[model samples]
Structure formats: structure tokens, C-alpha cells
Target: MVRGKTQIKRIENSTSRQVTFSKRRKGLLKKAFELSVLCDAEVALIVFSPSGKLFEFSSSSATSTTERYRKCIKNLRPSKQMDDSQHFEEEVAILRKKIELLEETKRKFLGDGLDSSSIDELEQIEHQLEKSLRIIRSRKILLFCERINQLKEEGKILRKKNAELREKYEERQLELSIGQQFSSLEQVKEVETQLFIGLPNR
Candidate 1:
């Protein structure tokens, strides 16, 4: 009896799987041979069993056929530029992942999380953090210096106002003292004149 049509997925039963493998392998080889013979064309087929047994078929000497295959592969190889572009894309992806990981580790080191990480990766992240810290410290120092300079300018203005007030106070004090002296002298003169004018004995 003919077997039912089988699906292309892996067969679960061990015996059935092996039997299917053998049947398909033979059928494929048979078709390849028929095609080669009908077309009068060179053909080569290689099959390997799941158990590591090798099988080979070639219309010509295996060596010559293999050489021809190698030549064809050489002629059809992808261009160097294409290979370089593909490699560049892979490297860029790797670098982007590294940057993302470093950023995540930076957050962890700054008390963000307790993610599992390697010591080496942590060290790299630490170095990156150190660099960022230095930059932040430098900026902070610059801002502080600017603030200090502004305060100094303000202090200079306050000092100038203080000196001006002191000078104005000194001038006011001198004017008050001179006016009191003149008034006291005038009073003394007036009393002497009155005493002389009213004196019985001089």
C-alpha cells in the first residue's frame, strides 16, 4: 500500500523519521541522476546521513568536478565592498549595544539598579563615568568662579557706597561742630557786653 502524503516538518517517531530520511535521500539522488542522464550534463551530488556517513556521486572524476565547483565559487564570490559594508553594519550594531550597556551600567553605578554585570564591564563603565564626572566638575568650578566674581563685584560696589556714606557723615559732623562753635562765641560776647553795660564798678 502507498504511504499517505507526509508533511515537511520533523517526524516525531524515530523509526518513521529514519525511514523517511532514507526514502527521500534515495528519491532525490535518483531524480538528480535521471536529470543528468537526460540532459547529458555534468552533475555532482553529496549526501550525509544524520549518523555522519558520507555519500558522493559525480558524472566526472570527483577531483575535476570539485575543482570546477571551486572555480565557480571564486568567480561568483561577493565583492570586497559588499563584504566590508556588511562587516561595518555588524560592527556598528555591536558598538551601539556596547554603548547602551555602558549607559545602563552607569545608571547602576550611580545607585539606579542592581543588575548583574561583569567586573570588566563595570570597570569600563567606571572609566566612562570618571570622564563624565571630570567634565561636570570642571563646569561646576567655572560656574562657581563666575558666581564668586559677581559677588566680588557686588562687594566692591557696597564698599564704595560705604566710603561715600562715611565721607558724607564726616562733612555733616564738621558743619555741625563749626555752627555750634560760632553760636557759643556769639553768646559769650553778648553776655560780656551786657555785664559791662550794667556794671557799677569796672
Candidate 2:
């Protein structure tokens, strides 16, 4: 008869639970020991009952086997130190190349490395310089024209003010001249009357 699968629920009775724990613990230790002996492998098992009694088994010294496992895990994993060193070396190489490129460019801009450049590159640089110069000259001419126009406007205003001042001065001078003429005529008439009066009394 095919036995039905055992339902794997918790044994609720305290006596039954303790008895089951003892049986299972022994079976587990026996299996661990047999596997170690048959396969010539290191093995360790530890179990504790509900009352805190310890049961254990080891094919080799438990401490030695645990240490060996740790060493094996360490050897199987990659080294972070080596990876960091390699990454730093790669970054240094990239920075060095960048510094070299920047230095070369700086030398070119300062007109110190033209001999190393190709003819085409020199022509391109010359063309760019010429274009920049032309644009600068055009801007200078426009600014100068604007300044000249502004100065011309100022000169026109000054000329108009000078003409007005001149007219005012001329009008004052004409008034002064007429007053002087009237005073001179009055003096002459007084002098002639004095001479005629003195001569007629004689």
C-alpha cells in the first residue's frame, strides 16, 4: 500500500514534541556522520533541544572546518583593493592625456606651436583670425561714424547759439552808438552858442 504523505504540522502535545525532537536530532546526526565518512568530506552539525541541552557532530575539528570555509570564500571572491588600484591607474592615464591636450592647445593659441600644425590647420587659423579682424574693423568704423554724427549735431547747436549771441551783441552796440552821437550833438550846440554870445557883446 502506498502510504499517504505525512502532514508536516507542528506536534502540539509537549511529550510528543520532545520525543519527536530527540528522534529527528539523532537521525540528522547519523546522516551527517555517514555522509562525511562515505564521501570523505568535512562536516559539522549542531542542535539544541527546547531544554537547552546541546547535541553536536563533526567529521573534522569544527573550528578548523569553519576557518577553512572562510578562507575558501575569501579566495573565491574578487579583491576590491586590486579593482580600486586598476581604476585609479586608468583615471590617472586619462587625466594625463587631458593635461597634454590642454597644454598643446594653449601653446597653439599663444602662437608658439605653429610649426607642428598641418598646413591646412594653419590656413584655417589664419582665416578665422582674418574674419575676426574684419568684424572688429567694421564695428570700429560704425562706432566712429556714430561719434562723428553726434559731434556734428553738437557743433550745429553751438553755431546756432553763437549766432543768437552775436545778434544780441550787435543790437547793444547800435544802441550805445546812437546815444553817443546824441550827446556829441548837444555839446557842439552849447559851444557854438557860447561863442556867438561872447562875440555879439563886443
Per lDDT, the best of the predicted structures is: 2
Against the true structure, what is every candidate's RMSD?
26.5, 32.7
Q: What is the lDDT of residue 59 in candidate 1?
A: 76
Q: Tens-digit lDDT track for model 2 on 1-202?
A: 9999866999899999999998898899999999999999899887888899988899988888888988886876377757877999999999999999889867776688898899888887788778989999999999999999999999999999999999999999999999999999999888743234344553
Candidate 1's residue-wise lDDT over 37-65, tens digit each? Answer: 99988888888888888877777766788
The top-ranked prediction according to TM-score is 2
Query: Positional deviation of 58 in candidate 2, in angstroms?
Result: 60
Kindly state the number of residue pairs that clash in model 1: 0
Q: Which residue ranges in model 1 land beyond 4 Å of their true spot?
A: 1-116, 193-202
Off by over 4 Å in 2: 1-106, 189-202
Clashes of each: 0, 0
